[model samples]
Target: MTGIVNDAGNAATYAYDASGNISSVARGNAAVSILGFSPGSGAVGSNVTISGCGFSATPSQNTVQINGAAGTVISASSTQLVVQVPAAATNGPISVTSPSGSATSSASFAVTQSSAPLIGGFSPTIGTPGTAVSVSGSNFQTTVNENSLVFNTRTALLSAATATSLTTAVPTFSTSGRLAVTTPFGQTTSSQDFYVPPGAHVVSDVAVTGRMAIGSSQTVSLTTAGKIGLILFDGTAGQRVGLQTTSSSFGSCGTGSLQILGPGGSSLGSTALCNGNYLTAVTLPTTATYTILVAPIGTMTGSVTFTLYDVPADAAATIVPGGSAVTLTTTTPGQSEVLTFSGTSTQRVSLTLSEDSGLGSDCTYISIANPDGTFLVPSTLLCSRNYYSNVLTLPATGTYTIKLRPYGTNKGSGTFTLYNVARRRDGDDCPWWPRDHADHHGSRAGRVSDLQWICGPARKPHHESGQHSLVLLVDFEARRYGPLSLRGLWEQYIRRATDLASDWHIYHPPCALR
Candidate 1:
């Protein structure tokens, strides 16, 4: 036995065996003490650090019980022991037993049930205000006040809630945004934005009368104009709205066409020529009632079956110059994909269409139109294979619309590139000047003559001596040079002028020639 003084200045005695191993120690009846613990409350399986004195150095020898359940000790020291709350632990005192003795905490450790809520999916993903949408997931509380659902910035009213699902009424102020749910544990938001359409209407089995007369036409009334309307011909897909007659007296059904007339009988779009079967997609330009005029090429009489579906108004995707190529799919026959882009006057805009393979006999059609809805360049001929436009030079600077669709009953997928080409600007001199002059002479001459007439005299002369001398001689023999001679001399002057223009890079000719 040895007498010693503890760090606290308390008298202590140590007893050891013959091997000098300390078997027991007495600290004047000083029992194990628990000062306090961090995070006074925690859920099951939560790690807690209890700070106190009189604990075994070996963690396995120290037994820590939380809420009447044995806690697993992670580490133990003379003054501290880290333990994990055991399963089925309740709210009760935390007691620790060291080799010396045992002691209980002054306060009980709180055990809480907590878990983050999860969302699987929702019903009626989209709806107008005052719509009730049901959400399904897990870890929802049975208590109503504990759950919160929000659509965008507005908090929705919770009608009911379960462990796996929740029902909420869409708030009136909700906009097109994410739907989020918050619980005591955590919060989660939807992966996609809920779309709230502005409005919608559907018309079924609309009877369209096909007329044989050239001027005669039929009309179909629509509730909303300026919106997209999908028309189904003959109650089937991939069919055109027109008369189908077998009589030889009737011309080819391919020649039939329908014109969309505005409320006041104003044409909204260029006539959609029918190819026997038709499913036309049109955007009404006016809110007033509209009509579809059937203009068959030959005498024909038939009742066409059609259904009109009104779709919400949506802006066409804009494709700028040098932008990524756009892939267009003709999901339905005669379905048009509209694209708008800004173009400068004389900008060489070209479109290259490449059809997908295995699409036998299917053709793609592209049409370039002005902002006024008039076709700047009507739909090109059916392109069964890849087709490249003739490098169209924009006539003016404004927004241009490009419509892509499948020709006739052909429907498939294709990709098109709309990009600006770096073309040689127009001038008096030809790009291929002095080489292959004959081949490009006529085009160059026409361009120069048009520019000269439109923009007045050329800024610079083509030939210092020859062209000027010829013009002077023509004037000198004005009377002798007949209309035919004068015309011939004028042609020569235009040819020479274009050559000079090409060299100076004055203005670029229209893309038609390219």
Candidate 2:
């Protein structure tokens, strides 16, 4: 046996000689002392080990900081630590801080630069919190502990790893940011980001006027002044909802956008769309049926018909680039299909949309919107049930929304496909980049490109179709980004991972990160 930690969180470390016999076992030590670390030096994302005493048993409580950056502790014990170096780390003294005390190695750890890890694709892009997310990439650390898995800024629990792939779960407080894996070789982040919405499911469709109630839908027109379409839906005390109103004529509200009244005829909140049509949300204060007052905005007039949408802020879906075409179906006249993809400002993208043939002409209408429920591309009504998008430049960095609705009460079905688009530059977000040691935030660091991410320096070419890639067949969302309180969620991840230990494992040193 190499080493074992007792139930008291006290660990005994052992070193064996070539003869298969124990050489040294340090026990009963309390002071934090560094026996020294191996390889002596490595790159920014390099993984390393430090032998010592008086380290905390809870791995998350151990802080291994090299220079000014804090390393991620994969596993630890009272006598040793296994950590992946931080991207911001540099040549400096290795300091280990635990709940028990602090220890500094006498020797300084060296930080060198190397080829960074690169991402090719990821699977099951849409998920709620705690969902397992698998990433396909290159130059990743072979050993799981040697690589750091992070979503936004929260460090995810590393489940497995290889040279080209890694597995982790959506951290509790996960919102937005590309899947970033830091390794001894370097660091690489995905071109696309991940999202975690609250939850979403189709409630109902209101084609013909019906009673205003939960799961019941209604369609109304605001052609004349004071024309209002009202709806009443039961809401839980803390439920939040997003309402989307679609129509053959989808336009902005000039004077007033829309009104949402709570129980007892009280105004809860109001949502307005800037350019394109979207449903903003409001939190319900009590469990009761609430009224949705849809009135004309600005100078909107005529028998202009619009669809109603009550999207409860949490549910969403995703599309795999260069994968199979997704079939969208609408059983009711007022229903619409919504799809999303990650994008950055100035990034160009392409798409193909076609309605199921033989359904007659002029049945489908499509539109692309910004992350804030505004217009990126305005609505386009297809006359032949076929639409091909132009090379379009994205205006911001976030999840872009795509909406498909049947025009003018014409119920229809269709297929939509988005080609793979990755934006990068030399020594930027692309693979094999050996210069920058910091995280590659795509929006600010690179030029827009739709080129394939091969295992070499990125090159430019007219974007092609059907690129060979692992297809993700599940739904995903661009986790909306905002100020998140991480203390509660972050602790859950760390404690959950810490429980996986046998309550007595001691890591050994002299292992190289690569």
Candidate 3:
């Protein structure tokens, strides 16, 4: 505190709070000492040097600031640091900071704004996602986020900056254009164009294509054969949408060559209208703009009517085992309805999908999507209609979706019900169901309905655990099984352990199962 040094050894200065008390993120190591800085005043984007002791040789490790605005360190040594005056820097004292500590200059460092930033060049003109590109500029905000850099329209991540330089990477899904930098004053672009390959940018960010919602219709004219007319719609992944078209030349039925292109310009789904109308459904892969390209089948010119609609699915409706039945309806043969149920990994659930109209499989096509949106069962309209009853042990503990598609050419409704009571497929439906084995007291075990448990609320009870297995026991031999009381069950367990010539130890159970 008594040294002649008025600057930080790392090339920054101690910061003062509102009350003039010093406040800084830097903690000075006793080894750090700042002597002074040369050319104490400089304009924004200009460089100055500080003479110090115990500074870092690594440039980035040494932090320098003009007043409160942080500057980027371009070079450093154990005793000297060269730093640029940051954009947004005003007239104030300069400071230097490192891992050791911070020290302020006794005199103020003047910050002058001579002009807006200028981009001279960026090395290696090929702009691709993740490629490191360094930009030469002037009057740039030295703080990383302060300088807004973009490769074409896509914003690049700013890695480093100084008064006359910027370092960043070409952003993913970026278009080809000159490197552009924007500061508080204004924006500037490089003279040379950075070559980012075309098409990649269109594929990743097709967000705002049209203002059309479900049930809206639009018309576009196809003048000649093979002429593609594109309509844009914004959609997200895991969504299913339907497309239908009508033209006077093609009749009232959906007739036209329509193809869907994803944001990345990849084909999602397409259908060609020959002598008949065409309709199809699609599930999107990512959130972006999807293009519906309409083309005439022949050399006929007409205004085509196109309608976009959502596939009906109630994803919010959840049901419990033996809960109220849910009715799924569809107007088209290929349409499907989605319903969900929450289940655990250890649970075995049963589902029944029936048609009271005696159509059975003719009215229902049932498949499932797991918690992660992967298909558990891929149900199709082309599949044979049969009674859909599945008893399966769930894969994970989350909401499992059931896709109930209406099968056959005739569309109607189907009743769906879910049940938690299911037998294990390994042939041991109820492994814990007590067997009426003759004990020393000749007690007969009574049976209850499927998997009726008297335990937990969230976790599954271990069948082998003594305390859990006790709850599964009924009053088969009421008095012989120790009156079914908690204490009586303990005594019966001890007596039975001796009778069965087995060692049954009492263990504490969580006693909670979903």
* TM-scores vs. true structure, each candidate: 0.29, 0.27, 0.43
**CA deviation > 4 Å runs, candidate 3:** 1-63, 68-76, 82-88, 97-216, 236-240, 246-249, 252-255, 272-281, 310-324, 328-335, 339-364, 367-402, 406-413, 417-514
Question: Candidate 1's residue-wise lDDT over 49-165, tens digit each?
Answer: 987667898999898988679989998888789998887789989998988788777568999887888878888766767777899888887788889887655688888999999
Candidate 1: 10-residue stretch with minimal lDDT: 477-486
Candidate 2 TM-score versus the reference: 0.27
- lDDT tens digits, residue span 1-514, model 3: 2133325423334555779776753434446666567676777677888876767889888888787889889889977899888878998887778886776766677775566789988886664477788898688977877789976456888878999999888787664445678986678977666654334332222211232555577776655544445566667778877766543455533445666766444567665533223345677776555667655554545566666767654333566765677876666434656688887887876565655343344534567778998866677442332233334677888988887654433356666667565442343322333333322232333332122223222334443343333322222222112111132244454455435222222232222221
**lDDT for each residue of candidate 2 in 1-514, tens digit (9 for 90 to 100):** 4345555645565666889887877764445656667767887655798887778889988888898689999888877788887888889888988877776765689987777799898876645568888999788877889899876556888799988888988887554345678875668776665543322211121121222444444455555543444444556787765454444243445545555666434566564422334444456787644556554544554333323444333323677555567776655444567788888788767666766643223355678999888887789765555555645678898998888755434445667777655454455432322222322122222222111222212332112322222111111121111111112222332343233221211111111111
Which regions of candidate 2 are displaced past 4 Å? 1-261, 264-286, 291-316, 331-334, 344-346, 357-365, 371-374, 381-384, 395-398, 406-412, 420-514
CA displacement after TM-score superposition, residue 39 of candidate 1 (Å): 76
lDDT agreement of model 1 with the native: 0.54
